[model samples]
Target: MLVALGQLAAAVVVAVGVAVVSLLAIARVEWPAFPSSSAR
Candidate 1:
């Protein structure tokens, strides 16, 4: 039971980490586009 709980915790941590990383990546990609659009 302890091992299963540990695995679940690890999975949750990994999922959250992935989500954060993806959001940062998307923000970085869009960061430059925002200024160019506004400049027009």
Candidate 2:
């Protein structure tokens, strides 16, 4: 039971980390478009 709990916690942490990284990556990818779009 303890092992399962530990695994669950690890999974949750990994998921959160991945989500944060992906969001940052997506923002980085889209960030350049904003400036040119507003210039139009």
Candidate 3:
């Protein structure tokens, strides 16, 4: 039971970490595009 709970917690943490990393990566990719678009 305890192991199951621990695994669940780890999974949640990993999911959140992946989401945050993905969002940051997207933002990084789009950052330059925003400036160029505005400059147009």
- Model 3 root mean square deviation, Cα atoms: 4.2
**Where does candidate 1 clash, by residue pair?**
none
Q: List the residue pairs that clash in candidate 2.
A: none
List, residue by residue over 1-39, the lDDT tens digit for candidate 1: 999999999999999999999988876677665687445
After superposition on all C-alphas, the RMSD of every candidate to the true structure, in Å, is: 4.3, 4.2, 4.2
Candidate 2 C-alpha lDDT tens digits along 10-36:
999999999999988876677665777
Total clashes for model 3? 0
lDDT of 3 by residue, 1-40 (tens): 9999999999999999999999888766777656874456
Off by over 4 Å in 1: 31-40
Superposition TM-score, candidate 3 onto the true structure: 0.72
What TM-score against the true fold does each predicted structure earn? 0.73, 0.71, 0.72
Model 1: residue 26 alpha-carbon error in angstroms: 0.1
Candidate with more favorable, higher lDDT: 2 or 3: 3
lDDT for residue 32 in candidate 3, whole number 0-100:
65
The per-residue C-alpha lDDT of model 1 at residue 7 equals 100
lDDT, residue 15, candidate 2 = 100
